[model samples]
Target: MTERVLVAYASKNGSTAGIATMIAEALREQGLAAEARAVGEVESVGPYDAVVLGGALYAGRWRREAVRFAWHHEADLTERPVWLFSSGPLDATAREGLIPPVPGVQRLVDRLKARGHVTFGGCLQDGAKGRIARMIVKSGRGGDFRDPEQIRLWARGVARELVKEVATP
Candidate 1:
């Protein structure tokens, strides 16, 4: 039987959304029916057999909307299989170890009992935002920090897990 998966993301500058879309496509390739939607647009999680929530990190935090989405649906989410990912660490080597989420994000994680959280390197666009955002991007290396191969590998693992779940019962 095929499993239904929802890939939800909150993105600024489109980095996280791009990652979510690729992941959804990869899951489809693995024979799962998956859809990628923005966090705001998802009205209900009742239809999905599995959920993948992801967002871009800014100032070392996941986006506010993403956190709230998890919070709002915590009970439903906790009862189902869920995975989480974050596009973070603009600096290539900053994610060498397990970096715990800050207090706010920790609460979000606890609510869903998220199976796993992976931090991928994000991107910075030149002159895309106002003074402060521009300054932040310029202060860091301004380019796409995302590794497509790593993203694909991780999505494959998640898809496999979903398949395994379907096979179990």
Candidate 2:
């Protein structure tokens, strides 16, 4: 059976949501059945054969809703192939190299036995909600840093791994 994957995420602004959409699209291109949904809106992870959970980082932590989703669905997640990602760096650090998951997210990785994880660049633009966000945009520090090709590349890698596992045995 083709793997049905869930690319779930918790994004404050629309950046992280965009990233998740890219991931799901890439997965579909690779021939897997995939869907991206807000972590909060997903009622359960039971229907998915694999999951890619992601959240935007803030103040060295993942969005609270993402963490909550992981814990709430821990049992189901542990039984399947899972991947994790965090998008929050406003700079080029994420694109230049690996930025390890923040402490809290790392804990979730360990607990869930995720197949893999990656850190991706974040985007902050005008009309962002918080005061700091507005300040950053006003100060000319805000712009989209997410690399769509890089994200698609990562998603394809994930699809390959899933294929390999399914073909085993």
Which prediction has the highest lDDT against the true structure? 2
How many residue pairs clash (N, CA or C atoms closer than 3 angstroms) in each of the candidate models, in the order given?
Answer: 0, 0
Backbone clashes in model 2, listed as residue pairs: none
lDDT of 1 by residue, 100-161 (tens): 66666666777789888778777778755557567877787566878787888889999989
Reference-based TM-score, model 2: 0.98
Question: How does model 2 fare in lDDT?
Answer: 0.94
Tell me the TM-score of each prediction against the true structure: 0.90, 0.98
In model 2, where do residues sit more than 4 Å from their true spots? none
Output the number of the TM-score-best candidate: 2
| Alpha-carbon shift of residue 125 in model 2 (angstroms) | 0.3
